[model samples]
Target: MAALTASQAPGVGLGGHDGKGADAAGDASPGDGSYDMELPPLESPNPPGGSAPGGVGDKSGIPKSVLAAYKKAAKSLATSTPGCGLRWELLAGIGKVESGHARGGAVDKEGTTLRPILGPVLNGAGFANIKDTDGGRWDGDTTYDRAVGPMQFIPSTWARWGADGNGDGRKDPNNVHDAALAAGKYLCADGRDLSAKADLDRAILSYNNSSEYLRTVLAWFEFYRKGTHAVPDSDIPPVSVPGLGEPGGGPVKGTPERGGKDGGKDDSATKPGKGSGGSRGNGDKEDGKDGGKGGGHDKPSPEPTAPHALERATDQNITAVAGETFAARPGVRAETAKGKSVKGVKVRFEIRGSTQATFEGGAKEATVTTGADGVATAPALAAGAKTGTFTIRATAVGKNLGTVDFKATVTAPQADKVTRTETTALVADKNGTFADIAVKATRKGKPLAGTTLTATLADTAKGPFFSVDQQGKQVRTPVTVETGPDGVARLSGLRADDKPGTYTLTLTAEGGAKVEVQLTIKG
Candidate 1:
């Protein structure tokens, strides 16, 4: 296994590079058939980022004809072994690294110096014959005998494990399709799954028969995973923050109904109002404190005393206002062995994700810290963001610590907009009612009627926007539209049965002018 360190080269400035793996950084050979290139350290056999030159790695010096050939090779390899866990792009990177895209049949070779290039003959167990043809005999212990084909598979292992990856009847080790399949199989073989770091490390070791290979592969995997597109955290739609949507701190106080299997008690019922438990001993009535009698803390009759056992921290729930910085949320809860709140207990916070491994372009990492109220708050998030999930872990200055998880759900507050507004915004004024609103289509500020306006309820944000193409998924109800001669369209009887969130009203004018306004509705 080979361990390649990340390259420390600065950003390459290649205005004319145009995706070519050439001397983008002002280092080019004068028709010497060579070019200088800088790379991040090669700590792993896999490229640092999932991307390599020429759709796999940099190949600027190589002519476009060569790049086309390599791309064609990559496509064939990828399509051949859809079942293989290894990506063709990674395999292509290995090909570019091992043989310089050379597809000629195996050249008789031996020794570690040329092992990566002559991998096919060595790993295929036919090295002795090829070596004999080349007027050389195998030393049997050299790195040359261990090398495989384009992606470098060892012959002894490949002979038993090599597969017809492309299923083209010929298990040609020299062929990119076969070699890539073999590499994929070798990487994802039994007890080797790329998803797990340990398994991926093990698979990397098998590829080149070295621990260094495992390390390099891990580094490359990290780089690739980060560089590729991943599921975004903001895909979820914004919802109104609980207990803050209505006037006067939301819904007015109502009768306290016992929470049932359906909806729970309203905000006012559970709010921290007068006579609510606010003492530190709210978990119990011990020491003459004000809490439910014998609330589990009063008596610890059967408990065993263990010096190594850590006490459980109790502060779990925290509140934050929407659109405000989340830094007020406490990262840690102070507590004692008796479950009592411990003030001034110091704790540290940290966060992690797949993005942390590589260099990020100024993206802020989430931070957690305690405040005067013993609460930790998250950073101020951006607007229009729909999704976020975060975990706040706390470590006591000593060994005892705890963790809390939080997810952000954005509920866009009620706002009036000339173009887009929720339905509630239209009918929200209980004291004032506007009659028969007229919707008119205009082009260049002139009324143009006889147009069609289709209204659709937002299913799940983007879901509603594209629902017209969703076939049966969209609701069967239709939004009625009436057009007047002055290009005025009147729509009425919009019912509450329509899905909440953003509903788009698409207007298509007679002259093909079109516009869409999103309306949000609340239940």
Candidate 2:
């Protein structure tokens, strides 16, 4: 049980590199791995202006192969588990936390770690007592199991969750693709939607079962949520920030420190010794603080006085202009199981799903404690430049009533003026694709970015149709394209009909600007 989260289970206390046993974490049902009952208010894990790997990612310091692996896993999971709402950012958050993107992108082109990044053995001495489940197959330890690979999955969990994400036929935890997809599957298990805080908390807790781990992973999750750019696959040496992404923000015992010139050599001291952060919260043999490291050890997190349930206290649906504040402040109420008002319980309000919106300080999430009347109101929400609908999730932290989702919409003030960038007539032979079709969208002579232009035939019939291959069949349908930084978007794959005739194609931008193109099909 220690290996498969016997000690890493939620409420098992802060495990993973800490020197402590399982501590009571609220009313978490042991290994059930859900915080729907948490009463703490939803808040951002990353504080505003928290120090990040300054130059690593996109300034996204993630290695190219690692980034590709994350994205590839996410994309594959979307098709397999669309309800999971898995995003690459979550994988990056775990990768960043688990092994700092394979120790600062020290992996080969196939996304395998240059050297084995192993954790201290779970020998029941100071760490979780997890016996070998992979027969020393993955962790190379036949006596006891160890958390292995970039995602730091122990053998038992890997046995159940391992997947061949890269489709290499063999499920290898050392491979970033397989490990990342496995992490996504583990997080999304049991129909969990990552957009919800309760589900997200449970997913993370099931991985490490520590409040500190939850907070750290959430911090990285939110930081990545803001933005992450792909870095080059160049041989950038590993440079881990202290207490940023690693265990307790320091080096684990038996592992090379971040930014250390360890030359990607294999770890000889794989077994964590007395003072290393190998044990779960049971630090070193001396004082149980940060496994003998300089930092303070993780103490048992204080459980919150939770509320029973949460309901919308204000309008659940809101609308505002792009880049403007909504008139209605999203709010929710906390109640007990008996429907009694619960006061002082924190309710966290967070932006969820697709949209660019934030509270003050560009914070995508916020926490508000319930008032005397049991109601918690969030601050005014300012919509970002992106125009679309999304949900604002409210969770009664530490309480398991699930979450309340509020719908919000942001509208653009005006439509850009869309004009044809290519004046050439769209002439195509029957069944031939119309090539070199392009459009530019601008507002007041300035190019617009992220402008949506939907291209369609004036008449669905008797006109050249946009043919696209779907599921091995060619289907005719209208297509939408978005403008880039330069405000230009292009189109292709428009096929001509057998009847050679003149037709008109229209490209309409979201804000109402429309441009017409003449299409001539030859027989």
Candidate 3:
């Protein structure tokens, strides 16, 4: 469920929308099931004054050329899903916000290409080592990166949501047409109703996966729209699925099938396996020696103890988001040395090292086994977890004893959420330092775009210096500034040396969040 929050106006600068709740547009019936209608082509809403679409220099930084590209792309997608009018400028805005209009090549911190919208590019050459090899490794927890191409779909997500828009057989998310169609299709499935406020808001939430995220996107939309209107219905085409009746209609089949050409699945959908979903490696093979040895050995036993040990219990691997709670399914394997299923032996899951933390395994233990199905789960942990490599040891004890090792790593969360709140001392010299400093806040390691920040500084003996406004304006008194899309605010040219003592910098944000720092000036 989306959290309740308010939507703030754009002029408020750094502070996002203050209004909360979904738009009350058309509502779908509960238990209505999924939509199975033949899908229509996508379309765009008409703008006010019917003026030419806003371009980059509309002073909004949205280039006219890019807007034109959006229009062209929207036209083609409209052919398949009618009543789907995605704003040309919104598409451009997303491109700008995500990957700097493809100029920066949307990359994670480790420099790996990310899909602008849908991603985790399945079947791509770089999927296996993406976590270790990519330059833009978000915080260490996220396996995906910023994204490449105009669409900005993260690689992993792209693997699941990508499609062949031009029918060229290649599902290139970087292609503008393909990306735009996917964006529109994603919104529709998420229940975006251009005509209704609630649906549109909910659709936005679906896009970012959070209510706060939806508000930020909408605020940006409002800023870009300024005088523009929604894309008109006339430009959109009706959906055309062979079996499904029409767009938004109930699903033709009870459930959307998996492993299809389009790759559309409900967010709440589940996959097969003994765990919550499935594991990264082979799900059914079990092989290794018993746990009679200690936890820190370098290699496994040379030969398999059970004849089918390698075939029954498959090795499990996971990349954990440091400081977050996650569960591993099929946590234990119920097998004997012969690879036979053990009916009543209780298996235990444990972790060792500086990476020590806790899970929801009922006790200090992460989890226990009920039967022979190899399954174990872990509880959530606190933030600020120690960063490094860790080992997960799975031990099974029935009449006989056995153990296995599955390698794992713990890394920081991606940039979406920032964990390190720092206070650095600034040196003031003969040259006056830019008094105004911008504090960029990140949530989940990703920049928390559009946050409002208020900075107050009191010199021990010098009193107040000057306050800078959001527009970089220097005012005589203290002032409040909102953060931009990068979650940054600047207080330039402060008279640090003039104070000659300890100065305290405090920042308070919306949602009642606050951060403070101390600065020392040396003569």
User: Highest TM-score among the candidates is held by which one?
Assistant: 2
Candidate 2 regions exceeding 4 Å error are 1-59, 234-523
> What TM-score does candidate 1 reach?
0.25
Q: What is the C-alpha RMSD of each candidate to the true structure, in Å?
A: 31.1, 24.6, 26.5
lDDT by residue (1-523, candidate 3, tens digit) is: 1111112111221111222332232221100111112111122232334332222222244333344445655565466555655665555545444333332222222112222122222122222113311222211112323233445444344445555555543444445455555555555553344547766665554444334444445655655565433221111111111111112111222233322334343232112122211111121111223433322212211222221111114336666566665444325445322234445445555665556555553333554544435333334433236667665566543222334565666665433422223344555653256344657666655676656666666543353356446996544454577666777766566654354555676766654566666556665
Candidate 2 lDDT (Cα, 0 to 1): 0.63
Give the candidate order by descending TM-score.
Answer: 2, 3, 1
Q: Top lDDT: which candidate number?
A: 2
Q: What are the runs in model 1 whose C-alpha is more than 4 Å off?
A: 1-85, 100-148, 220-523
Can you write out model 1's per-residue Cα lDDT over 293-387, one digit (the tens) per residue?
Answer: 32121221121111111122333443232232333333444432222344444455433332211112223344334344444434343322232
| Candidate with the larger TM-score of 1 and 3 | 3
Could you tell which candidate, 1 or 3, scores higher by lDDT?
3
TM-score of each: 0.25, 0.40, 0.27
Lowest lDDT 10-residue stretch of candidate 3: 27-36
How accurate locally is residue 277 in candidate 3, as Cα lDDT from 0 to 100? 13
Candidate 2 per-residue lDDT over residues 254-359, each given as its tens digit: 3454334533422222333222112221111212333344423333212223353576788878998786788898888776422356789888898998887999
* Ranking of predictions according to lDDT: 2, 3, 1
Could you tell me the lDDT of residue 197 within candidate 3? 76
